[model samples]
Target chain A: MRNRLKELRAERGWSQQDLAERLEVSRQSVNAIETGKYDPSLPLAFRIAEVFAMRIEEIFLKG
Target chain B: MAAYNLAFRRYIRRFVPLTIAYGASVALATAVIPDGAPASPGIIAIAVLPGLAVVGWLWAMARLLVELDDEYLRMLEVRKFLVATGTTLALTSIWGILELFTPAMPKLPVFFVFPLWCLGLAVGAVFNRLRFGAARCA
Candidate 1:
């Protein structure tokens, strides 16, 4: 999966740690997701969507 | 998170004491039971202590898996265990076959399986580092 996590986080001026804190995950997890090394689970994708106030599809795209 | 930290701390607490117990039990068993000593009840009890300590270690690991909240970290841990299991099984199978065929091969002790599994955990950690760019979950 491809995600706009980095771009969205950048637009909101949120560091990876900030987003990780908000998501209750490690900063490494956020970095992994951003770099496409790991794909978030459905629940985590929803949580990420909720954090960004966007739908899951908007944040994550099919690769 | 506090939960992950708490789980990790609990794992450490259990692991340390279990390790000490394992060592002490092994030393005591070695000293008390001389080579080729017949298995009495007392000797059997002493011999079982180290195995029990290894069980405690397994229990501690299972508890950590259950208590860990971070899904990704939990997944990584599960993967490590899977890798360790596979490695241990494969090596044991190969060694067993070699021992069967080669008369010069030394008989592999069953107790060494636990240590081999532990080594496999280290191998798994290296695998995680190569695949996920982190050796330790924390």
Candidate 2:
């Protein structure tokens, strides 16, 4: 999976840790998602989308 | 959700050290042979009890992680489970091969098997953590 998490987080002036805190995940998990090393499950993808107030498609794309 | 995660982390910090201590004691007993030769009757129970306790603690820890409102916990757990299962199967096969080649080899007791199981588990956990980048497996 690919995501614009880093860009979105940066636009909001949020560090990876800050995004992780908001998403209720570890900073490492956030990093993994941002770097495309790991893909979040559907519920977690929804949580991430919820945090950014965007549709999941906007944040993540099939890869 | 964040606070709940922090709370669970706190609980784990409190539990892990004691669990490791008990585990280490069991491992140490398995590593050393009784000075005069024969394995003692209590050795198997010694290994099995502490090993079972560690497994129980891990199950509880996984439950606590699940309660903390992160679905990724389940993914991390499933990954860890797969790794451990694969490794256990591999090691058991190797042990069986070794037994076939050396039929007179001293039988490993249940106690020795417990620590060996833990060692395999730890190796599997490390593999999962490295591959998945999550400490939850540990």
Candidate 3:
């Protein structure tokens, strides 16, 4: 999966730490997901979307 | 800051007591039984009590992992445990095969598996640090 997590986080002036705090995960997790080294589970994906007030499809796309 | 949850704290607390008890039981069994002699069924049962504690520790570890809400820490833990499992299985199987052909090799009991697995986890923690920058886990 590919995601616009970094771009979205940047647009919101949120550092990876800021996003991670909101997601209740470590900054490394945000980094992993952003760099495409890790893919969030469905529940986590939903949480991410909720944090950004966007749809999951807007943030993540299937390759 | 890297932090552990209440469940993790409880897990560690539970581990300490169980480990002390396990050590005591193993020590008592070894001291009371004769060396190189087969023990009675009752004595064997007493000696294996520490083995049950080892299984309990694994269960606690699993429960701690499940209770964690942090994704990255959880990922690190899952990777570490998988690496540990692979290392233990590989080393033990190799040793078992070698013992069959090499008369000089010492025999390994099945009870030693958990200790080997624990050693593997230590090795896996080092691997995690190299791969992920830090070995943070609950």
Docking quality (DockQ) for each candidate: 0.63, 0.38, 0.40
Residue-level lDDT tens digits of model 1 in B1-138: 456678888889999999999999999998899999889998999999999999999999999999888777787888889899999999999999999999999999998999999888888888888999965642
Against the reference, the lDDT scores of all candidates come to 0.89, 0.71, 0.84
lDDT of 1 at B105: 91
Off by over 4 Å in 2: B1-55, B104-106, B133-137
**Is 2 or 3 the stronger prediction by lDDT?**
3
Number of the top-ranking candidate, with DockQ as the measure: 1
Q: Cα lDDT for residue B3, model 1?
A: 68
Q: Write the per-residue lDDT of candidate 2 for residues B98-127, one digit (tens) a residue.
A: 777888865554445545555766776687
TM-score of each: 0.96, 0.70, 0.83
| lDDT tens per residue, model 3, B27-107 | 988888787767789788887889788878888888878776776677778888999999999999999998999999999
Please provide, for model 3 over A1-63, each residue's C-alpha lDDT reduced to its tens digit, 9 standing for 90 to 100: 999999999999999999988987778889889988789998999999999999999999889
| Candidate 3 segments exceeding 4 Å error | A61-63, B1-4
Interface RMSD of each: 1.2, 2.5, 2.7
Please list the residue runs of candidate 1 whose C-alpha ends up more than 4 Å from where it truly belongs after superposition: none
- RMSD to true structure for each model, in Å: 1.2, 4.5, 2.7
TM-score of chain A of 1: 0.98
